[model samples]
Target: MRIQLDDLQGPEIHALLEEHMRGMHALSPPESVHALDLDGLRQPNVRFWTAWDGADLLGCGALKQLDAEHAEIKSMRTAEQHLRKGVARALLAHIVEQAQALGLRRLSLETGPVPGFAAAHRLYQAFGFQECGPFADYKLDPHSVFMTRLL
Candidate 1:
């Protein structure tokens, strides 16, 4: 799969992100749903990417710079038809590599604690992310699970 910087304008990506938002809201309470919409992901501090095989969009992920040395992972989602196909893994590995290339010292993320998010938790843990307290504008909440890793 080819992972490339995304401009967030394609219909395919828009549909995928909308699906991601719906899934997030379905799994977690409104207050605990931290997933970024298209506008949020388009912010200057955020860099987004999409993985594709020819015309098929496999997955996407983003990194939002919180500071010169810290960044937060956002909007990670694998297309429903592409789950368990390493699409997320490829996007995540690409994001981490890009973060390191940017000279960022840490990478963090917030995800839901429900069974629906089990695969995500395992994926992050396998990538060396460990549970941590809230960071950035986040507050401690039972519906959220925070994880971070030093670059």
Candidate 2:
């Protein structure tokens, strides 16, 4: 799959992100849902990308720069039909590589603790991410599981 920077303007991506937001809200309570909307992902500090297999959009992910040496992974979602096909894995690997290239010293992410997030937890763990307390603007929430890794 070809993974590249995305401008977030395509209808396919818009639909995907909308689906992502809906899924997040469905799995977690309103207060626990941290998934960004289209406008939020368009912020200057956030860099977004989409993974594609020729004409098919496989998945998408993003990194939000929190400071000079820190970043947070956000909006990671794989298409429903593409689950278990390494779409999320590829996007994550690409995000990590890009973070290192940006000279970032740490990468952090917040995901849910529900059954729906089991695969995500395993994915982060396999990439060397360890559970951590809340970072950035986040507060302690039982619904959230924060993970981080030093670059």
Candidate 3:
């Protein structure tokens, strides 16, 4: 699979992001949903990416720069058809590598406690992320699980 920066302008990418947001909202209560919408992902500090296998879109992920030494991972979603295919693993590794290249010292993320997020928690743990309290504008929420790793 090939991974590259995405501008969130194409129909395919837009659809994928829309699906991601819908899924997030479905899995969590309104107050606990933190997934960024299309407009939010377009913010100047956020960099988004997509993974593709030739013409097929496999998954997408993003890195948001919180500060010189910190960043947040966002919008990590694998297409339903691509689930369990290692698309997320590859994309996450790419995100971590890009964060390191940017000289960021830490990478953190917030995911839900729902069963749908089990694979994500395992993946993050395998990458050395440990559970942590919320960071960046986030408050303690029973539905949200925050994880972070040092670069």
Candidate 4:
């Protein structure tokens, strides 16, 4: 599969992001939901990418600049049919490589704490992310789990 920068304008990507948002909302409370929407992902400091196998969308992920030396992972989601197929792992690896290329020293992310998010937590842990307090504009939230890693 190939991972490429996306413009967030394609129907497939739009649908995937919508599914991500829906899943996030269902897993956490409205106020605890931090997943970026389509417009939010279009911000200047955020870079979005989509993983594809030929014409099929496999997954998507994004990196958001929090400061000169810190970056946040955002909008990570694998297409339903692509689960357990290494799509998320490849997309996350690509995001980390991009962050390192940009000279970011730290990478952070926030995800829900429910069992529904166990696989994601495991994935992050495998990539060296550890639990931490909220960063950026985030505050202490029961439904939210914050994690970070030094690159």
Clashing residue pairs for model 1: none
In candidate 1, which residue ranges exceed 4 Å CA deviation? Answer: none
Residues 1-151 of candidate 1 have per-residue lDDT tens digits of 9999999999999999999999998998898899998899999999999999999999999999999999999999999999999999999999999999999999999999999999999999999999999999999999999999999
Question: Cα RMSD for candidate 4?
Answer: 0.5
Cα-based RMSD of the predictions, in order?
0.5, 0.5, 0.7, 0.5
Q: All models: lDDT?
A: 0.96, 0.97, 0.95, 0.95
C-alpha-based local distance difference test score of model 2 = 0.97
Instruction: Give the alpha carbon lDDT tens digit for every residue of 13-107 in model 4.
Output: 99998899889988988999999998899999999999999999999999999999999999999999999999999999999999999999999
lDDT of 2 by residue, 78-115 (tens): 99999999999999999999999999999999999999
For candidate 3, give the lDDT of residue 127.
98
Q: lDDT of candidate 1 vs native?
A: 0.96
After TM-score superposition, what is the CA distance of residue 109 in candidate 4 from its true location, in Å? Answer: 0.2
What TM-score would each prediction reach against the true structure? 0.99, 0.99, 0.98, 0.99
Supply every candidate's count of residue pairs whose N, Cα or C atoms clash at under 3 angstroms.
0, 0, 0, 0
Which scores better on TM-score, 2 or 3? 2
Looking at candidate 4, what is the lDDT of residue 137? 99
